[model samples]
Target: MSSASFSEQSSDDPALDRIGPALSRLRRRTPASSKDLSRNLVLNVIADAPGETTVGGLAAEMGVAQPVASRTVAACIAEGLLRRTASQSDGRRTVLELTEHGETERSRFAAEQRRAFEEITATWSSEEQIQFACLLDRYGADATAWSRRQAASRD
Candidate 1:
């Protein structure tokens, strides 16, 4: 058989097996930052949230414990990165919103990420970079939906 045909018959699982090691290598090669990753994740989630965000909502969205989400929110508030505002519809309910400083920080973070991405993919063609990004985004969304469905089924 031709090499191309032989390769086509190879087990698909081998390609899947490389994902974990590839991610680990990427993590190791990436430079460390002063900012905590979990905190950054929380900030991004809040900034992207569809509506008013609560600690409970954050916990659910992050798949973290309530106390963990509460503590992160508290730290963000203390750092002036976030604020608690009374909900207009409910007087007693407080929602978490990004402070002006938080907005600036988020923008900075996004820019930095974009720069890093560009640097890492500098050798790749622009079309290849865009294709990779689009595929990665679709994979993430599909994986999240699948996870939620699996969790719901378990419940």
Candidate 2:
């Protein structure tokens, strides 16, 4: 269906169909730096984990191989963004923690992202921007849940 049809239609499927193209355009327009993006993701995942996070756990969360996660962790360590210390609950195991520098970098990244969002939605009303933010957050959470379910089914 064309964009014109979208305005007249109220069907869920057609509305959902717009997601792919919209995301594609966004990706094309704002090409991300994969290395920086990966670092940011690693910081966020480790920060959000409920318990002490390990390299293996980080790999699972990132959907990457253990070696890949290890390499990333090593890089983060080298950059003073992450530190590996003995897990308090498990004397033999190591857990990842964000260094003070990591926290600073993560906060900086978030601020930059929010600034970009504000700029992109400058023309939008306050209510519309807030509603979109809520929906986008919900979508991200749901997507993560769905991904976990799919991975479980495969296993």
Candidate 3:
């Protein structure tokens, strides 16, 4: 089938109809530069990781290639935003950790994002905001679950 035919078949899919534009709008609204965004995301991931973070783990968690994660980690290390050390459980494995500067940067990034969200929803009613927040949280959880299932199936 032609690409146009495939598009026509799914054009009215409700999930796509709603989510596609919302994601586009969110991308347009985000204030951080793309480099800063990558930095912030990597930093946050390291901070929140349940176990020792590694370059490979960051790549998998972020859904990016190993090389991309490695480059980003290298830059962060150079900036003193992240530190790498031998894993306690496995000396051959390198573990990632957020430095104090990384923690501060992550917190600042989150605060800025929160401020942007507040500004965008300034006129929203309290109930509307609460409902939207809850739905967004649910959507995120559902998406993550779906992603994990797909990855497991592939393996």
In lDDT terms, which candidate is top?
2
Give the Cα error of residue 3 in candidate 2, in Å: 26
Q: After best superposition, candidate 1 residue 80: deviation in angstroms?
A: 1.4
Error of 1 at 50 (Å): 2.3
Candidate 1 stretches greater than 4 Å from native: 1-11, 20-31, 147-155
lDDT of 3 by residue, 58-147 (tens): 998789999999999999999989999999999999999999998998888888988988888999998988898899879866776787
TM-score result, candidate 3? 0.80
TM-score of each: 0.75, 0.80, 0.80
Q: Residue 49 deviation, candidate 3, in Å?
A: 2.5
Instruction: Give Cα-based local distance difference scores for all models.
Output: 0.79, 0.88, 0.87
lDDT of 1: 0.79
Better of 2 and 3 by lDDT: 2
Q: Of the candidates numbered 1 and 3, which has the greater lDDT value? A: 3
Error of model 2, residue 143, in angstroms? 2.8
Model with the higher TM-score, candidate 1 or 3 = 3
Residues 1-155 of candidate 1: C-alpha lDDT, one tens digit per residue: 99888777874658778988986675454334635555566788888776788888789878899998998899888989899999877879988899988888777766767788899999999999999889877976776678768878887
